[model samples]
Target: MKELAHLNKYFFKYKFYLFWGIVFTLISNLFGIVPAQVVRHALEMVKANIALYFLFENSSLQVSSYKIITFSIAVFGVLILAMAILKGIFLFAVRQTLIVMSRHIEYDLKNEIYAHYQTLPLSFYKKNSTGDLMARISEDVSKVRMYIGPSLMYLINMVILVFLVLSYMFSVNARLTWFVLIPMPILSLSIFLVSSIINKKSEKIQKSLSNLSTFVQEAFSGIRIIKSFAKEEKFVETFTKESENYRKESLSLTKVDALFSPAISFLIGLSTVICVYVGGQEIIAGKITAGNITEFIMYVFMLTWPLTALGWTSGQIQRAAASQKRINEFLKIRTDIISSENKNQDLQGKISFQNVSFTYPDTGIKALKNISFDIKEGESIAIIGSTGSGKSTIANLLFRMYDADEGKILFDDTDIKALNISNFRNQLAYVPQDVFLFSETIRNNIKFGINGVADSEIYESAKKAEIYNNIMDFEEGFDTKIGERGITLSGGQKQRISIARAIIRNPKILVLDDCLSAVDTNTENAILNNLREIMKDKTTFLISHRVSNARLADKIIVLDDGKIVEQGTHEELLATAGMYRDLYEKQSYSETVPS
Candidate 1:
């Protein structure tokens, strides 16, 4: 219950729905006890009429047995029949209100969690797996729905039913009520023991299920690699182990859940037994009527229904509590990156990094060290580096994927940190080294981030990225579905689609982090030539290893060992006869001697 307190805001948000559900639950339970009382009165009235007739034997004023029986039947029909229908109607209403509210909350929660995921730093995503996050949103949220909706409704119904029945029993015969309630303490203790075990097992089951989900997601995502490596058997075995663990945990929970009903039923049976004995004795001693004992028995039976349901309801609560704990932990995570509270200053794309340094949080290895550079608006700068030389890291910093650990990065002389992150990011377009295109149509993929951009703009951007002709070659043109992760498209096609996606955004700065490596040199040259016109009025940073790509930039910077070692025009770097010169000579010589 404490774990579920985080839902208070949503509960209040939809309090009107909850209020009606609770009211209906109460009404249904109220009507639920009327049938038992009606049965009791019918029996008492029939007995009373028989006694009256016997006392007035041979008299014309004697009550008729047929009239008394028919009248009792009428009372039975009116009270019991009508109440049963009313109870069912209200019960249906209860479900409609509460269950609907739970769905609304679940919908809201999913959106909220997704929005939070977006706000989280890139490091958080690196630490967590996609499957684990998916589990939280899908499975964990359903568990929470159980707690808030049907479980809660039934719990309230049980309380109201128990209260009305207990009060009526005491009113009819206090001593009998006392005797019958003797089993309560034992019942409570058993529920407590079983609930504790249930809580622990439920948590394990949820965690095992998450692990299973993670395994499946990873296996599918890496299926090509697994087939190439011939490790399908290994993955299958691992999956089998995870599945076994999940089954064990679920069975453990089921075993405890199995104990609840029988334990509760056995305990409740004791109350019924006590009611019959005490009630029968009271009737025999003439302290109470037979009708009173019959009514008490019926009330005990009424109590049995909720008590039996209590077993299942308790298990549901324990499982939901476990789920709520997991959900709460995920929601409570504070994003490492917080945008500025104040409105951000306008950016003109005058980018500068003053002695910037950064290290990845998990590895603690400096990806960029004491890096300093500045690029004026509309200048095309190229970065050339070997693998792990911080070329992509520079692009990441510019996009605010991860902030620099030391010194400052600025846009238009305004500190990047002082600018609103959304606005700052909106001013930049980045095409990362690893391309990711969603399983959408080519048109939608190109027009993803930029809304209201016409098909004409999409076509123009596609042409600029040198993918328009390839798209037109497809049977469906822009409407074709690319399958999961664009698996149907070639690597070069996917990269070009990603470039087209960025080109349409029309940002103040563009960062191409090895986005053209999949394409042949000729295609890369054609795309770069088109990009030159688009980037004429925007700051462009080209991160590539190819000298052919770097030579096109107005200025080129060489990086080695996470530091900028050389910076100048490509000719100036070649004249220095250093690292850049060696790279150029190797590329140029390779080109001349190539097959």
Candidate 2:
């Protein structure tokens, strides 16, 4: 009942169409029973007075029995035809309306689900699988749509059909009707027991399908890696296992579903057999007319279908309920980007960190801790650290991917927690170490986040990043499709395009998070030179392992294990003989020398 009420609200928009469709279906069913009743009445009338009317001596006959029989035949024929036509029309109307409504439900679910994705934190993506989310929006949502459309109509039809047939059956023969009700209780019990098992099995199958989807998604995403390592057979073996599991689960479901209707039909047939045996005995004793028995049989046959369908509808209800539970669970996850009735301050990017600490939620290892720092507006600061020395964690904190537990991240000495996070992040842009590009044209990728950038501004930013000339050399230039993950671009080209994306944003706080790692030494130097002068008045945090990049900053902070251990300019840091200087010597000694 709760599920039905929930479904009613969910499908309320299409209820009017469904209501009219059901009305037409009911009318058709009402007329559809006329022929059997007419047959019983005609038989009884013909028996008593056929000879009197035929002899032409019964002047008292208001209407001839022959005329009555002929008229009944014509009326029955037209009524049967009208029933068929109305049934077809109602079926068509229901189908059309449900199709349209299903599309609307699917469209809204996909869009809203994805919109939820956009608001969820980075940790949410880390914890969940993209393929699972895709399957929910595509396959699971489709299951819900099926329930709203055909399954729902079938359910309603069964109810109306049962009510009509049962009412007629009870009116004609109360004892036989009571006997029929016996099988109904058994049928309901069977449905209840089997449906619980079916629901559990179906949910397991859906989860297994989600796992298979995850496997396929991962395989495609890492195709190049798999091929390079010659692990095609391993992946194929894994996929085969998942596919076999899926097939077995689906076949198990087929077994459950296939048994339902046949079992229902058997029980219903048993009831009818009992009814005929009892009613036949009564008719022989002259307890009821032949017409009542005839009409009763017709009603019994009609009632069988609705009883049988109860078993089928049980299966559908379980499947739909399982699907609804999955969707509801997804919707329950709270988004990390908070939007509440409470207000927050606007930001001006005078960033300060006080005793900040962060640990990955799953791993429980501190990625950053006691990381105290301050950056005045327009100050060019550099973070020099080894690979795992929490350089990127700084950038992540600034972006508010994971909020700190022990400290305050402030902008203009105001806690960022009190600010609108989206509005706060809008003033900053990051050029990450590993660049990610969409499968789109180079121009679109450059102008991605900032869509309002002019063509000239795009070209200027591209030139500054040292990739403009290379782009122009291509046949289609910036308009050429970058292929999957910008595969068409060389590593250095991809990096430079990423830099151009950051540059075009013209952010108040620009983070160069090892942005030069992919580029050649010459290209890196040129791009940094241009960027340093252009962003002189904008606060910049340069993060890198190489001394050359850090040497350009006004102040350099060297870190080890989430805490800064040294702070100085390039010469001062080298003179100090700290971890940064040692790392610099190792990297510097490996540089090229002209032969």
Candidate 3:
């Protein structure tokens, strides 16, 4: 219940619905109690007529007695039927308000979680799995809905019905009322003992289900790799283990749920037996009539469903509390990156890394050590480094995917952190080393970021990436749908399509991080030739290992062991005989010697 306290705001948000629902529940229960009283009067009327018939035997009064009894019984029957009909009408109204309100809350809650997910930093995703996130928003939310909807509705109806029936019984005879209620405290004690066990088990069950969901998601995503390695049987064995664990947890909960109905029915049956025995004793003592005994019995039976629902509703609330606790965990996570309120700055792409230093938070490895560089607007600089030399870290800092720990990064001589994050990112386009494309058509993939883009722009961008002829060869061409993460396309095609996507943005600054690695040398040269023309007036950072690419840049910076070992024009670096000249000589020798 403490965990479920988070939903108080939603309850207040739809207070009108809650108000109407309670009103309907009260009216319906009131009408529901009327039928028992109607039955009592009808039975009493028949019993009195029987005595009158015996008294007026063999006389003309007997015929009149029969006529009166028949007409009165018929009226009582109609009255009971009317009460039942009214009760049903209000019950429908109860569902319309309370049940409908739960659905609205569910919608708002899911949207709120998804919107929060969009604001969190990349490091948060590294800490959580995709399936766990999906489970929280989908499965956990559904359990909470059950508590808000059917469980809540039944709880209100049960409470109202019990109150109305008990009040009427006490008004008629307090002694019989007390006897009928003997089993209630015992039933409550049973629920109290069982509810604690239910809360603990329900938490374990939700966690196991989350684990199962994560396993299935990863297995399906990597099915191709499994099949290629001929490890299908291994995967099947692991899946079976996860599935069996889930089934065992579920069975434990089901065993507890199975106890609720029988225990409730037995307790309610005991109440009925007590009512009959006590009412008989009272009738024999001439303290109450047979019809009064009948009325008391009906009242006991009227409380049967509500008592039964008590145990079930208790279990539901415990389960809901467990689930809501899971949801609150993610909702409580605060992102480190907060966007600036000022979004009016326009960037001219003059970038500077002023003695910047950074360390990877997850790995605790220093990726950059007092690195400093500058690039004026309209200049192309290539960052040349071997693997693990921190080439991509520069690009990440420029995009503000992360902030530098030690020094300032400036754009147009202003601190990048002070600028509006969204507005600052709008002027930059980045093509990562590992390309990712959506399961969409080529044209839509190319035009993903910017809206209202013309078809000609898509065609021109594809041509600049040197994938235009290959697309034309396909049957659907630009309309062709690429499968998940562009798996349907070859590696080179996927890379080129990503390049086309970045090109269509026409950003003021472009960072191509080894994006042309897959294509052949000829296609790479052709794309680079097109990029040189496009980058004539725009700032570009070409991050690559190949000397061929670096030799064409206006400036080249060579990195080694998390520090810049050299920085100059290709000709000047060659004159210095530093790391850059050594890399160029090795690459040149390898190319000249045949493979």
List the candidate numbers ranked by TM-score, top first: 1, 3, 2
Collision pairs in model 1: none
How well does each candidate superpose onto the true structure, as a TM-score?
0.96, 0.90, 0.95
lDDT of 1 by residue, 258-333 (tens): 8977877887788888988998988888888887878787788778868777778888888889998988887899
Candidate number with the higher lDDT (1 or 2) = 1
**Residue runs of model 1 more than 4 Å from their true location after superposition:** 51-64
- The whole-model lDDT of each prediction reads 0.87, 0.79, 0.90
For residue 527, give model 2's deviation from the true position in Å: 1.4
Model 3: residues with Cα > 4 Å off, grouped in runs:
54-64, 285-287
For candidate 1, give the lDDT of residue 544.
Answer: 92
Clashing residue pairs found in predicted model 3: none
Whose TM-score is higher: candidate 1's or candidate 2's? Answer: 1
Q: After superposition, how far is residue 558 of candidate 1 from its true place, in Å?
A: 1.4
State the lDDT at 123 in candidate 1: 88
Cα deviation at 251, candidate 3, in Å, is 0.9
**What is residue 569's positional error in candidate 2, in angstroms?**
2.4
Q: Model 2 scores what on Cα lDDT?
A: 0.79
> Which lDDT tens digits does candidate 3 get at residues 405-448?
99989889888888888888888988999999999999999998
